[model samples]
Target: MSYAEINGLSLYFEGHGSGPGEPLVLLHGGFGAGETFAPVLPALAEQRRVVLVDLQGHGRTADIDRPLRPELMADDIAGLIKHLGLGRADVMGYSLGADVALRTAIQHPELVHRLVVVSTPARRDGWFPEVVAAMDRMSAEAAEPMKQAPVHELYAQLAPRPQDWPVLVGKIAELKKQDYDWTSEVATLTAPTMLVFADADAVRPAHAVEFYALLGGGEHDAGWDGSDRPAARLAILPGATHYDILHSPLLARMVVPFLDAPA
Candidate 1:
C-alpha cells in the first residue's frame, strides 16, 4: 500500500508489477475502492505496470471532513498523478470511478495517455441523477440485514464473485456524504478514450452509444473506430449488470488489449 496527500486528502493506493513499461492505473466504482480490481490486475501485470488507487472516502483513504463531489474528487486524482511523477499512463475506471476518470482527463489531459471507462453513463441525459438516487437508497438500507443483499449474489445474473462485500457497503455510506454531478463533465473530455459498458448494467447500453455520438460520429466515432481519434471509444459487453461486471473477466478482455494497444 502507498499513500499520497493531494488536495488536502489522503489518497491510498496499491502498486503491483515492475517494469519500464508505461503504467496502467485502475480506479474502482461507487460502492467500491481499489480492491475491486484485485482479481484482474495479475493478468495485466504480465505486460505492464499496474496501480490501483482507493479514491477519497473509500478504502484506507481518509474521507473528507467537508462535503465532497466528483469534480473535487477528480481534482484530487489529477494532483495525485502529478505528485507521483507519472506524466502519462493508461487510466481505466469503473462506474463512479469512470466519472472521476472522465473529469480527470478533461481537467488534466497531459497527465493521461489513454482513458478507459467501464459501465459509464452519458453526461447529457439525467443518468447521473438516476444513479445517485439508487446509491442513496442502497446506502440508507445497507445496515439492515433483511435489506442487505449479498454483494456478489446481487449481481449474479451478470457474473459470479464473492469478494469485498463489507468494503462495498462501506463505500455506499461514504457516497452518501458526497455531492458529485457527473453530467456536466462529459463534454469537457478530450483524451483518447474508450467507454465500455455491460448490456444489463444499470447504465444502459444506449447511453454508451449516445456517449460515442457526443464524441463525434462516423469513422471519428469513439464507439466503433479504434482509429486515431482517442477522445473516446465505446464497447458494450453482453450479460453484465452494473456491479458484477467489475469482477467479471469480460471487462479484462476488452480493457487489456485496449491498454496494450499502441496509442
Candidate 2:
C-alpha cells in the first residue's frame, strides 16, 4: 500500500510481486478500487511487478473537486508513473479504467511501454443502444441499489469517504452522459496495444472489430510466416460477459502472453 501525491490527487497504489521486465500497472473499473483485480493479480504478478492503482475518487483515493474525465485521469496516471520513477510501464485497464489507460497511451506515449484495454470502446456510440440507455439512466438515485453490489461493498470498506458514494455515483453518471470519440487519437497510438473484450459485452462486437481496425489490426491475415501480423492484437473471450469477464481467469491467460511478446 502506497500513495503518491500527483496532480493534486493522493493517488493510491500497491506493488505486488517482483520479477523481471517492466512493471505492469493495473487500473480498475469505475466505482471499483485496485482490489478489483484480486482474481487475476496472482497470475499477472507472477512474471513481473504488478502495480494496482486506485484511480481518483475510488478506493483509498478521495474525490477531488474536478469532474471525472479520462483525459485528466490519464495525466494523473502519467504523473504517477513519473513519481514512482518507473520511467515506462505496461498499463492495463478495465471498463472506466480502460478509457484512462487508452488516453494515457495516446497523451503520454513515451511513458507507456504497452497497453491492454479491456471491455471499453473507443467511442461512446460503440456501446449497445440498451447499454447507452442504461448509462443515461444513471444518477445519484441509482446509488442505493448499487450499495448492495460487491463494488459498492468494496468501496464502502476502502473509500475514505464512504458516505460520499452518492456523490461518486452522480459524478460517474454525469461523466457517462458526455459524448466522446477517440477514433483519430487511437489510430495514432504509438504503444503496442491489445484489446480484450467478452463475446457478450456492452460494446457491440462490430465496434470491437472497428476498434481493432483503428489500431491497425484485423484488416489483414498474418501470412504463413507471420511477418504480416499487426502490432495490435484482439481477443474475445468465450462464455464471458462484460459483468464477469474481468474476474475470469482467461483474462490473465490471454494478457500474459501478449505482455511477454517481443517488442
Which residue pairs collide, candidate 2?
none
User: In candidate 2, residue 202 scores what lDDT?
Assistant: 87
TM-score of each: 0.77, 0.98
Model 1 accuracy (lDDT, Cα): 0.68
State which candidate has the highest lDDT: 2
lDDT string for model 1 (1-263, tens) is: 77898878778877888665578888887645676787788876777778888776565665655444556787887887887788887788887788778777877788888888887665534255576676557653454462255434433322212233444455556655455445445666666678887777776556667676666533454345544555455677777777678667777787777776665
C-alpha local distance difference test of each model: 0.68, 0.94
Off by over 4 Å in 1: 124-185, 217-231
Cand. 1 TM to true fold: 0.77
Q: Write the per-residue lDDT of candidate 2 for residues 74-154, one digit (tens) a residue.
A: 999999899888989999999999999999999999999999999999999999999999999888899999888888999
Model 2 TM-score, 2 decimals: 0.98
